[model samples]
Target: MDPVVLAAGSALVSAMATDGWQQTRAAVVEWWRRRRPDRADGVGSDLEAVRAQVLAAREQGDEDTEQALAGAWRLRLQQLINEDPALADELRRLLDEHVDPALSDGEQPQHRPIIMKAEARDNSRVYQAGRDQHITGS
Candidate 1:
């Protein structure tokens, strides 16, 4: 075989391989999208549970404790989102509503935030105190 032709063939093969890889990646993403829950519509348990826990803590007259817990919870959730990029977008959408509610409007609930999960409701979102954006799911 001519050296020039061989080299050209090798380059063509390499380009084909790169294109195939790109297609595979796009397919995987499309599949994941089909599996992904609606960020705006899907209700998560992680945030709901966190909200309940914070509310309970506050009701127990532990305002400081509640704040600490909420902060830790948010950090952990953010971390989990980092681990699973899809979850981050969902979490962000869900929390966007309450991130800074208009408390002065008297419409904001006095209770804490609710932790929600993208999939299972039984699993709780756990936060590690003193750690920023570090989370573990139950």
Candidate 2:
């Protein structure tokens, strides 16, 4: 998948979970209106339906369902980009201008880097993770 499509899909799902979702949803539908006027209404309705599902999934702590919803939107976006290619720019703009801002308004996760150093006389072991990691030692 295109990086922009991936980012936009994730942002779209994240925005749907925010209080600013209505505005973000409107922008998305309007973008679809310009690109595929005939399908705009259906697209809007589908977005709303998906948003409802996402909300319910979050309430139930169903990460799998939320991720599945994101994947669906990613596929939809991938199809759009495959058809027009130029829509990739529009998706990036939507993510940068609207979706990302809405997500920022909500609680943003904090990430911190990890640094580790280890030394031993007989042996040495070191484990480091800048992000998520798993390690086993013997």
Candidate 3:
């Protein structure tokens, strides 16, 4: 899992401001730079791309994708907490605000695949990519 993603997850659990999210993302970028020095930007775009996709999905009224993204964020947050226990308190607080509400009502949305095309790619990849990945049918 991406450490930057983990940090983002932690932020979700803490109601972190947008600047906090950018800082966490920056740390992840730095870590990625250290690990893959030869890759130039070293996959910096992945996280930004994911963030953008999530925002776009929210704007599109894609509830299922939104929920799944939230779940993924939660998982990443858990991973971050496991990696650094000191953040537990912060994470717990965030969960109290963001996660608990969804759980109490069993309001997690179901995934609704929106496939636009199929060809060289297999169904499994399409499924794994989820709605966002399948939208372009690449």
Candidate number of the best lDDT: 2
Least accurate 10 contiguous residues by lDDT in model 1? 8-17
TM-score of 3: 0.36
Clashes of 3: 1
Q: Which tens-of-lDDT digit does each residue in 82-131 have in candidate 3? A: 66666655544433444333332333223223466655545454334543
Clashing pairs in model 2? none
Can you list the residue pairs that collide in candidate 3? 13-94
Cα deviation at 138, candidate 1, in Å, is 58
**C-alpha TM-score for every candidate:** 0.31, 0.76, 0.36
Superior candidate under TM-score, 2 versus 3: 2
TM-score of 1: 0.31
Best by TM-score: 2
lDDT score for residue 132 of model 2: 90
Give Cα distance to truth, residue 126, candidate 3, Å: 56
